[model samples]
Target: MESLEHLTPTDREILNKSWAIVSKDMQQVAVNIFQMIFEQAPDAKLMFSFMMKDYNVTDQDTKTRIVT
Candidate 1:
């Protein structure tokens, strides 16, 4: 596996800056990420208890509950 140490200083800086922005709304970011994971691999939902039931639920608040 490639190591993060291979990343240039500029690359690290970009990642840090992006993380700072993303951290501001981590809940929504988490939901979006998880949704993508489930969409890409439906079987991945079985790994999380919260996701095992009714994935079609559209309530943003309920979806974000998994992250919290």
Candidate 2:
């Protein structure tokens, strides 16, 4: 695994700032990210049994289940 010790203070600051912006709409981001993952790797969806049954990426319940 990569160590955080390698990250410079400036890098950490930039990451924090970027995360702050993305965290504003984290629900949507998680949905979009998972959707993309499924699209890019159709087989990946198979790992999640819940997705096999009437899966809908935009559904709030599905998004909640995905991120949590």
Give lDDT for model 2.
0.79
Cα error, residue 23 of model 1, in Å, equals 0.6
lDDT of 2 at 5: 82
Candidate 2: 10-residue stretch with minimal lDDT: 59-68
The total of clashing pairs for model 1 equals: 0
Over 4 Å off in model 1, which ranges?
A: 55-68
- Model 2 lDDT per residue over 1-68, tens place: 37878999999899999999999999999999999998898768858888767554445755534221
Candidate-wise lDDT, in order: 0.77, 0.79
**Cα TM-score per model:** 0.67, 0.71
RMSD of each: 10.3, 10.4
Backbone clashes in model 2, listed as residue pairs: none
Best of the candidates, lDDT: 2
